[model samples]
Target: MLRLILILFLCGLLASCQYQRPEDARVQIQEIEGQARFTIDGQVHEIKGLAGHTHLQEAHSIGANTIRTYDTTGLQSILDSAHHFGLKVVAGIWLPKSHVPWLYKNEEQRVKLSKELAVLGRKYRDHPALLSWCLGNELIFYDLMDFDFSSTYNRLLDSLRSGDPEHPVGTAFANYGHKAILNFALKIRSLDYLIINTFGRLPKLSEDMNDLDFLWSKPFLIGEFGENGPWETEWTKWGAPLEPSSSQKAEITGRRFKELPREHPNFLGALFFNWGWRHEQTDTWFNVFSKDGERSALYYALAKQYGDSPVPEIPKIKNLKIDHGTNANDFWFESNQWHEAQLEIPESLNQDSLEIRWSIRTEDWFFLKADSPPPLPDLIEYASDRQKIRFKTPGKAGPFRLYVSIHDRSGHFAAANLPFYVVQ
Candidate 1:
C-alpha cells in the first residue's frame, strides 16, 4: 500500500509539470555565409516588409512577408492578423523625445518608461509573428546636437530584455547624427542591430556602413525610405517642395527596390516609407495608397519588384487639357464652361478587369505643414472602359489638380495628375 501511493503521487506531479510548459518561443537571427538573416521558428526568413497600417489582405497580396508598426496600440489584433496571413512584424514602442531634459533626469519618468517596456515585453514577447522589438523611431535625431540619452535608452532596452529574451531589441535613428548614434550604440552593450531611416541620401549608404563597421560590427536595416522627402526635394519660395508626380515616385521605387538587396550584405531588409496616407508635409508625399484606399502607381511598381511573376503596367496619361485647347497640356479652364479631358492609355497594358477612378479637389497648399492634416480629396467618378472625362470646372476660382488612377483585377495600378487653374 505504501509503494502504490508513492507511484500515484509521482505520476500526478509529472502531469502537472507538463501542463505548465510555456507556449511562447523566441525568434532567432543567425549569420549565414557572412550575411545576417532572420529565423522565424527556426526557419530562415527573407523580410519583404512595408511600414504603416495596411489592410492585411492587400499587404499579403503585394508579396510583403512583414510589416512594421510604430506603436503598440491594438497590437494583439495586429499580431493576430499577421499570424493569420503568415506575416511577421517588427513591433515598435514609442519613446519620448530627448528634447525634454527633465524626463530623462527624473527618476519617476525613468521608472515609468521602464515599466512600460516591461509591460510590452510580458504581453507580446511570445507572439509567433514577432520579429524584433524596435524601441523608438528616430529618437536621437533631434537630440544629437543637444543631449545624450544613452543611459535612459539603454535602461529601457535592458528592461525589455529582462522580460523577454527570445527576441532582439533595437532603435531607429535618422539618416544624420552618425556620431551621436555611434556613441550611444557603443555604450549600450545590449543592442542587437541598427535601424536607420533615410531618403535621398540612400545612395551613399554603403560608404556610411563601411564607416560604421569600423567602430561597431553589427547588422542593420533601413527603417524607413521613400523615393524622396519634402526636405530632399526642390522647394518653392514658400518653403514647400513641389512633390514629384506619382509616376516619378513609382519610377524611383522600382529602381530603389532592385538596388536594396544587392547594395550591402548587412542589408537584411527594408520597409517602404509608408503603406498608407498621412498628412506629413503633403497628403500625397510618401503614401503608397490614397486616402480612399486606392493603390498608387508605386504600389504596382513595388509589386513588380517584389513578386516573381510579371505584373501589368499602369495606364499612362499622355496629355490633359481643356477641350480642343491649342496647347497639348493646357490646364487653364473657365469655371462656367463644360470641358472634355482626354487620356491616352498605352497599348502595352494587357488588360484584365481594368477600372479607372477620377477625382478633383482644391489645392492643399495651406495645410501642408507637419502635423496638420489636409482634407481628403473628393472623388468625382468611378468608371469602366472610359478614356475621356467630361465635367464643369470648379465654380470657386482656385488651383486644382485632376487625378486619374487606373487599376486591374490582378492588384496592379497606375496613377497620374494634372494641375489646373479654374478662372472666374
Candidate 2:
C-alpha cells in the first residue's frame, strides 16, 4: 500500500512539471519597405481579415488570415475555430454603453470592468490564435466629457496591460474627425494601434490618414470597411434611411479593398466590415452574408480580392425592385398586398442549372439588441432561373425586405435584397 501511494504521487509530480502554461503569442507591427507589416512568430504576417462571426473555415478558405469579434461572448469557440483554420483573432471587449452617463466616474463600474478584463486576459492571453486585444468598438460614440473619456480609457488600458504585458492594446473609432479624441488617444502610452471603422469614407482612407500625418503617431488598421451605411444616407421624415442596393454595395466594397493597400502603405491591415448577418437599420445593409447563410455579391467580390483560387463565378442581380419601379429604392407596400418582384439576372450565366430562390421577412433591426428568434421568410415560389415572382405580403404592419438568391450546381451563389415598408 505504501509503495502504491508513492508511485501515484511520483506520477502526479511528473505530469505537473511537464505541463507548460502558454504565454503571450501576439502579433507585432514591423516597418517593411516603408510599409507597416504584421510580424508573428518572427515572420512578416500580412493581415487579411474579416469582422464579425461566421464559419472560420469559409473565412480561411477565402484567404483571410484573421477575424475580429465585437465582444468576447462565445469567444472560446471563436478562438478554437480560428486556430483550427490557422487564423488569428482580434478579441474584442465591449465597453459601457452611452446610456450610463457617469460610467467613467463610477468606481464600481471601473472595478467591475477591470475584473472582467482581467479574467478575459488570464483566459486567453496564452492562446496561439490571439493577435491583439481590441479594447472597444467605437467607444467614443457616447456623449462623455473629455476627462471622462480619457480617464476611462486609461483605466481599461491599465487593466488590460496588467493582465497581459506582451500583447499590444487597440481600440476602434467611428472615424478620425474628432481632434480632441484623436489627441487624447495619442496621449495613452499603453495604446499600440488605432483601429478605424468606416463605410463610405474607405475609398479616401489613405487621403484621410495623410491629412492626419501631423497628429498621427501610432500604427493603424481599417477595422471595418464595407458598403455605404444607411445612417450616412438621406432619410425620410419617418426616420428610415435610404439604403443603396446590394450590387452598389458590392462595387463600393470591392473598390475599397483594391485601393487600401495601394493607397495606404503605413496601414497595417484591414478587416472587411461584417462576416455574419445582423440587424442594423436594414437587415441587409452591412453584412456580407444573409441571415439564411446565403453569400451576397460582396462576398464573392471580397473572395476574389482576397485571392480565393478558382473563385466562384457568381451571377449578379441587375435589378431587384418592387412593382418594377424606375429604380431600386423608395419601395412601399401594404399589409397583405400582392406584389410582383422583377429580377433581372445577367444574361451571361448558364441558365439551365441556375437554381433560384426568393424570400421575404420582417425587417431584422430587433436582432441587434438581443438574440431574438430570426425572422422567418414568407412562402414564395421556388423555381429554376425565374425572372419574375409574385407573393403576398405578411399581415404584420412593419418594415420588411425581399431577398433573392441564385445558385449554380458548382456550389457558387449570388444574392440581393431590397427593403420596403408594409403599411397598415
Question: Which stretches in model 1 have alpha-carbon errors above 4 Å?
Answer: 1-25, 141-148, 261-263, 313-315, 319-414, 417-424
Q: Candidate 1, after superposition: displacement of residue 42 in Å?
A: 3.2
The numbered model that scores best in TM-score is: 2
86-170 per-residue lDDT for model 1 (tens digits): 8889998887776657667787888887987888788887788889889888765434323246567767877887777778777
For residue 247, give model 2's deviation from the true position in Å: 4.5
Q: Name the lDDT value of residue 287 in candidate 1.
A: 78
Clashes of each: 0, 0
- Looking at model 1, the pairs that clash are none
Could you tell me how far off, in angstroms, the CA of residue 411 lies in candidate 1 after the best superposition? 7.9
**Regions of candidate 2 where Cα sits further than 4 Å from its true position:** 1-26, 98-102, 141-144, 234-239, 242-248, 261-265, 313-315, 328-339, 348-355, 359-386, 391-401, 407-413, 419-424
